[model samples]
Target: MIEKLAINGGKPVRDTYLAYGKQYIDDDDIKAVVDVLKGDYLTTGPKVKEFEDTVANYVGAKYAVAVSNGTAALHTACLAAGIGEGDEVIVPPITFAASSNCILYCGGKPVFVDINPDTYNIDVEKIEGAITVRTKAIIPVDFAGQSVDMDLICKIADKYNLTIIEDAAHALGSEYKGEKIGSIADMTEFSFHPVKPITTGEGGVIVTNNEELYKKMLLFRSHGITRDSKLLTHNEGPWYYEQLHLGYNYRITDIQCSLGLSQINKIDEFVKNRREIVNRYNEAFKDIEEIITPREDEFSNSGWHIYVIKLNLDKLTCTRKEIFEALQVENIGVNVHYLPVYLHPYYEKLGYKRGLCPEAEKLYERMLTLPLFPKMTDKDVEDVIRAVKKVVDYYSMENCPL
Candidate 1:
């Protein structure tokens, strides 16, 4: 007989709740932050440059610009790319709203693209069809830590003379065709939020190989005010600066960078642990007819930020919400990654309507993220698996309640 689910008052598989994603902070990380707090600089200091250089070296990029948050990083990238009114940027709807919101921030229209149902990244085949004379760029997001089809995306961008601003917030440690995600795109953005692969409390960075773009991002990160002697048009003396362009105060703090420096040192290990957890989840759910595990392309090694499972609603009597709540009852902190960006009320009022991307809306209805983090132990992984299986089995169509 199948075990009763916790939603129906059965014993929970876990006594404590497990979060979907969390940062693994150690003593070293704390020490680093504290050291920065006691240092000579706090905001625009040597530590900021040090962190940028470290990220650049790690991702094999020519330069990196640390910013206050992921959204700021995206906005800075848009500014550097010269996205403006009447310009169109192609983006997938399945990602976080910030991915497309950055375009709107720059007075550009974000053209929503559907995702490949399997990989859940923007569909390469349909990208070209979205291109128009007004199209200036494509912001392909590396969803759920899996790198988007960069090779195909590059080809499309080259053919259309469009810039590629890859949103790699979930893919800092991920790899595509042996190259790191940051080094592949024209400008790649990374987030250092607490739940990300690495944590800086709240921080972000943009890395690029083009020096021109790099300098542009640097100015954009610092209120467009540059004291650089080379860039200033007129220098009164040694204490002169210029605000050449309109920019925001997107600068990141040295304290955050200090934490980031420590966190990045363990990124490989964190990624390894996440992948191992994903492997376990995949193995346990492979034979369950009510579930469809995430798929990774053979050419990619995902950083596995969050493990999401798609429910086979056809085989289950319960809705995704029912299953989500059921898992929560079993102490699993299951959550939805996103609703389609354009489906949000803000975007809806902006003239975007439903049925914009059929595939994304469908996937959003069926998908939910599972707990996958470096700190989760073997027992925690098993608890998640057991609770999921219990909930799914109880809700299976064959076991429909009277």
Candidate 2:
């Protein structure tokens, strides 16, 4: 089952399946999960604390709250940051839907901003113009692991008394302006989806320096029920509890925490391997005028969660669709990072037209995400490169320089 393609009628192609992203789980990770399975607490327990502490310490955040997934983390983050009804949260339309959806979950409206072409991130300069009396927060996504222009973003936030919630789902190990990203924002959310830099089988976390926000998120993550008697007006029993606020059961299991701990132990190695793959990709496509590779910010560091390349259609004989199909036929897995949030039929009805964000729209039309993960081998890299070159060559026959 593993050797055959799940699509295209299941024909055998290679010895193994090459996914766009995958986890590099070693024996230690397996053992950790197994140990949790054998332990008393399979849900929230000591391992969660250890995992949270590890993340907090690593990212220099004062506290971290593990949640069910990134969306839950975002929801809790918005709630913790005091985003409420009548509040307007400025968010980039280029991000995943959850980034904007979180604002709505907090009973706030989402004000969409356009993105910068080269970075594929929210345009910080364009952000200030969208602010209004109700504007309360700014959620800047670290698109594809590259840190956003935080210095300018923070500057704007300071200028407007706006709260900052970094959608760092793609940037766990990324840094900005010499400081780690999680520590920079008022609240930061991270994801551990299978395709992300790490895996916890759908886990997420909220990291912050504010104690009030941390406590609020903690309560929000666990059904808003509290066992501490101090918060209760009167203690009928020693087991008295309090419901301070409306919340959800967005708690993570100890099994996931156990896996996260193991994964964290090898994060450095995973990042190193990914960097090696990125270097290879950069070199392989360096001279190819048909694509534009991702660029790095001089003042920031990245985790490179995805390796997206923008197509240069002017020099190509094939359309984006044709090249994509050709690559699929050649057994290369391909994906588009996103369709602009505003282009979705739901948003279109909300008056978000095609030309609103020219830069993001143009980039969206041509971008393709190739296979990238720590598990990719030299042969896998070579195969992807060869497949891409073949597709480009086959489609651009007469237009080919040779």
Candidate 3:
């Protein structure tokens, strides 16, 4: 029905708008939440523990602690790692601000590390040069569902005596070298946001094999208060409790955990479908010179949260914004994954400046996230591909100079 590109006064790809990511809730998910609502315990209840145990088992971790959300998981992990004032944490600049903000939350300084231009993860080689006596930990993000090189990162941590808290917020189903993500890092954090591999409305969990860190994080999520018999110094009566340390009210609700338990049952299917969509996108755009599809390391089996495309500016007549807006004009709801974390005004106020991570800053200029969710039908996927091709073709330059 369409003869020309929408950006050039032609018909658009589709009549409806498609977002980059979305939740796929079904009848089972609904029943789980409804069942929780009708149950006795609502807040800190049995379902939370069940969900935590299930996730821990799923990821091969010894313990798991469910928290209110992803940021809380990061904060709790930071506290468990002993981050505090005068401490420094190494993190990639090419990720969500929460990855770095978690360090700030713990009274520690966030040292911005550049990304690998090929994989868009933190450059592990650059991490060593950034380390100092104050450096306490490294928060390596599994950006866009791909796992980082944990084997090499572990060696770095061992040499420097630094902790590793994997911000695997996008990588619940991802794997590294045939091993699952949660079991690979010292402590791994997962998000259960609607847009993630699974949904819990708003929830997060931290998993670890270390019993000490697990115990520390458990208390940290509950206002530093405990009523446990072993933890209490003086059990004057059944009601007696103690505040072990300064912590936060980061506990997740049973309702969310109920939804999470249901969601985890279908995580495999969710990840498989996401991979199929990514494959389709890659094949569709393979011959398009103006676009470069995302790449994963050979060791990474990505969970495929979002599929991003990088623009070849020299080969395109239009700018990155032009291509992004043109896609929007064609009913494609594309987005940018992130701007460099330190580039935000708040980070600038904290005394960070430009030229901190040149690769990340450059990546921001060309990156554009496309629509990719498990709920998308075949037609929806085709519509996105057509929309992208139309926009790129309209703006492409055959012989532009770099």
Candidate 4:
């Protein structure tokens, strides 16, 4: 017999709600933070530098600058890239607003690009069509921890002489053609939010191979105030500094970096575990006609930040919202990954209208994020699978066209 859905007052798949993403904080992480708290310097300290160096080395980048959060990282990267008024930056519409908002922060216009229907990343082939004489850069996001086609993106950037600011918030440990995400782009930014692969309470970092850009980011994060004698116009004896540019106080605290240092030590294991869970999810849903699993490209090894599934709505008797709610009733904390950045009222007020990216808007209507985290046990994975299957089974239609 087909099981009754919990939304219809039947038994739930699980007793407790499972969040879509969560941080895995162990005793070691707590100890690392405590060690920093007990030390002399809590804000501008050795721990922050240590964390930055570790990340840079791990990603094979020449330099890394730690900042208050991911948004600041993007903003500082934009500032370092010399993005100014009237400059245009190409960005995909499927990502978080911050991806494009950074361009706006630098007084630049963001030209929205559509995503490839399969990868849900910016369509590389269509990128050149959006470029104009005003175009200055391209911000390619590695959506859902899958690397964008860096080789193709690099070729495009080189041809246009445009800088590539990779938003790698979802893809720290992900690799493109055997190279780490952070090392491929001109400047790559990573987030250390609670729900990210690692947690620093709230923090971010930008990695780059260019020393000029690295130095600029360093100055930008600390209010453009520099005590370095090489940078100062005129230095007085011992105590002297200069505020060369209008910059924000985006410095990250050592306390957060301490946690980040600890968490990063386990990143490989975390990524491995996430991939294992994704494998389980893929296998469980492969036979379900009403579900379309995420696709990882041949050259990309994803870190699997969040497992997203697109419903084959025609094969089911319900809408995505109905399935989402049904999964919630079954104690599965299903959620939408995002609405297109331009669809938000704020962007709409900025003169971005609908039909800008039909593919992104269509995908938005059918996509759902399932529970995915490094700490999720096998049972947690099983519960999510059972809940989704139960909901889809209850709503599935007969003789549905593929």
Candidate 5:
């Protein structure tokens, strides 16, 4: 009843994981990176700037600042958005930790909000209830590559004078109301980790249309060293630079940017493949009463970064853990997308308690991400379908189906 995965199953899980998520690399992706390696600049250089522009143009943003990693992008966005000590940032509990961690980095407290189980997004209706004088911003995570209800979230932010920096790490190719995820949010952060829709090996970028924030992000990307002389009052010398504020060394290298550029070319291809896989999974699970499948809203299109399934806990004859373990025994590797951020011991020790976000806690009890990636083939898809079916049938409370 609690979980379907059996930990002590007396069987090895996977010699090599059919990981819940992973990256795909081709010869061309390799060649572009090699070309950068052969070039003169490796660290934050011309290619990094080029990569920023490429992403900006693709997402319809005025500026993009490439950073060392996704967490860095979130941290920089937090600072640029004017979040700091004594501020309270509203965020949903159904997200990866960095969404809240970024707020803490600015000495701000993250106010956890529950999500709408249907879309698995931060419930915009709950925003007004969470807001207080200390509130600084609202970070709505686009869970599973589906853009959160941005229009409503923005409307609430406008009323409260709060910033909305979308935690769009999983939404590169996702769209909301036909507008790209990156373009609609006041500020959106993207990850180019290998497992993401686009891979830069390990990199992230912040995209925005606000000019003042753009400059601040540029300065923050490289240890707060502003080389532009026009902004400074005194011209010390041609080589002079100023550490305008306490920033970080969160710059992305040209080598990574080269990989990103190459990956950009295949983004549409990757997205198409992921969509096909999700469709396959949807059809395979359509009639199974024991499991509830993923739901795609009529208004939004997901990049399908993850094909997460929430178990019909009330219907399943077997525990959630048993199903997970059953699949693992057959080498059909599966993983959970998250344990609610507030459920983590660190969050609990920080005074966050259970029931703070009831819906998210209930969701964490059953949410599991199935294997999904651009590289999956027909055989791989069948393997997963067969594994899940076998597990369900074998554990049926009724007589097993043939």
Candidate 6:
């Protein structure tokens, strides 16, 4: 039954290796960085404000605060939201470590919730059960660029007086219902890593409608120092500033902002192209019995960050690790999205144990992220599909024994 396997020496799908996700930097992106290099005030400058305003306008938010990276943005947002020691923030287990790490950064605890098996997002129903007298906020991640049910999340937040910080690192161009993601939550954080919808090398930003939170985030991004006269404690001279609160040096550079501005101009095209790729992948994999394509929530128009598939291990004769190795042998660089955050050693040390979120643990074992980036050509998409089919066919129970 295992005769069809690639390990027995069948030809691989492609001649070269393909990474799971990649950045697409055009000539314009390079020129934008070059222009920033020639300009004065590389950090804390006009370019940064321009990029912030552009994103603010795009996402329909009143204010946007640029920061060093996605994790920094999360931390600053938590700080602005008044999270502190003994506070508890509700988070989904099926997300990047930073989503929960930011809570710890503020001396707060993370109360993990499981995910909806179909959407792979935080289950709103489970959230209310986890809320306690110390509950402070909810950080629902838009995992894989699809927005969670914002209306329901907002309703829950309002009922409990909890702040909402949507972790939109994977969901820049995504929409919840007809509204853009950034404007719905109290504060939304976005990442500009190479693998994101846009590329700025490495950068992140937080957008909000609250003026008080906006100003606080600005102070937190740059060592908590404020040079404005209105915010100062005294009428000290030109170079005088006040340390308003304890904050971090999480400022983003003008070089990164300039590149981000250029990338923002092409966001529509980028999102459209990514959707096209996702559609093709879904169509190709639907008929295969060994896989389950990711399901997009009906209320969302996803930005399509990573194209993840769930292997139907019940129908497969080989293990997930075996299939992963088979894909690598075919030069298809597949990867796993996450292991439940609590399962990480650091969280275990914090007293979080396994079986806390059963669905997340189950999802982690079966999920596989494939190559899906805006710059991938049609041939690249086809090559990935072909490789997946080859691996699945070889491991099918009909061809192999369990």
RMSD of each: 0.8, 4.0, 1.9, 1.7, 3.1, 1.3
Q: Which residue pairs in model 1 clash with each other? A: none
Question: Candidate 1 residues 45-155, lDDT tens each?
Answer: 889999999999998998999999999999999999999998999999998899999999999999999999999989989999999999999999999999888889999
- TM-scores, all candidates, are 0.99, 0.94, 0.97, 0.98, 0.95, 0.98
Clashes of each: 0, 0, 0, 0, 11, 1
After aligning candidate 4 to the native by TM-score, how far in Å is the CA of 243 from where it should be? Answer: 0.2
- Model 3, span 267-312: residue lDDT tens: 9999899999999999999988888889899999998888888998
- Model 5 weakest 10-residue run by lDDT: 1-10
TM match of model 3 to true structure: 0.97
User: Which portions of model 5 miss their true places by more than 4 Å?
Assistant: 1-17, 400-402
- What lDDT would candidate 6 get against the real structure? 0.93
Q: Residue-wise lDDT of candidate 6 within 82-142, one digit each (tens)? A: 9999999999999899999999999999999999999899998999999999999999999
TM-score of 5: 0.95
Of 3 and 6, the candidate ranking higher by lDDT: 6
- Among all windows of 10 consecutive residues in model 4, the one with the lowest summed lDDT is 393-402
- Off by more than 4 A, model 3: 1-4, 399-402
Cα error, candidate 3, residue 239 (Å): 0.7
Put down candidate 5 lDDT per residue, 267-336, tens digits, no spaces.
9889899999999999999998777787767778999888888887676666788778778776877888
lDDT (0 to 1) per candidate: 0.93, 0.85, 0.92, 0.93, 0.86, 0.93
Candidate 1 minimal-lDDT segment of 10 residues = 393-402
**In terms of TM-score, which candidate is stronger, 1 or 5?**
1
Instruction: Give the 10-residue window scoring lowest on summed lDDT in candidate 3.
Output: 393-402
